[model samples]
Target: MPLFSNKFCPKKPTPRKVELSVLNKELGPEKALQDLGLEIGPIRLKLGDQESLFDNGEWLPETGPVSGTHKENHKLRQYVQQLEDENNLLKLKYEILLDMLTQTTAESHLQEKQMEQLQKQVLNSSRIPRTKR
Candidate 1:
């Protein structure tokens, strides 16, 4: 029996039975973190004196009612309201600008009509018979 025989060689095996989660099925953890404006890094998890570090943190359960989340949400809401007010003001200004433009256009049309009438009158007068004086 040969020691280095073809039977001893490792065969090219197929993929094993591995399960993929829903999140993994979709746009991956890295993409999900990016969408949520978070950086990829190690996460610390504790389970009654047992601490573990994980590369992916999206799956980690939140610490529930985080004070930082509340503060951030409060600030976000305030900024949103401010932006809404600014948008309303911009809308009002846009309406005013549109009205002014419409009024100016109407006035220009009226002036053009008046000029046309004056030109017609001058032409008519020139064509009319006049006494030699």
Candidate 2:
């Protein structure tokens, strides 16, 4: 009987070892592997490696301002404006109400004076004392 069968044979052979130095120099190791669609978690460099190569090349110095912060500031300003408008409206309404109350009070006082004069005339004609004990 035959010990091996052709069914178990691999369709393609894979290379086990690769040249690291040439690959590292050509693609700077990080970019080369990324270009090939490889994902390596944070690359750790040896103490002897070049510091500039390890530093992130895409760092920005003055990131300026974030849009969210500006948006929040704008929203805060709008809210303050709304509150001020509400306060002004309430103040105007309060003044109108106060004026109405003052007019009502003055009218009530005039009515009270007229009623007192009518009562005095009725008492004088009927000869009755209007004094309260």
**TM-score for each candidate, following the candidate numbering:** 0.51, 0.47
Error of 2 at 67 (Å): 1.7
Report the number of the highest-TM-score candidate: 1
Write out the backbone clash pairs for model 1: none
Cα deviation at 45, candidate 2, in Å, is: 35
Residue pairs clashing, model 2: none
lDDT per residue as tens, model 2, 17-89: 8887788798896788788767755444433322212227532222224434655777899999999999999
What digit string (tens of lDDT, one per residue) describes model 1 on residues 43-129?
A: 777666444455454433334445357558778999999999999999999999999999999999999999999999999999999
Best by lDDT: 1
TM-score for candidate 2, residues paired by index:
0.47
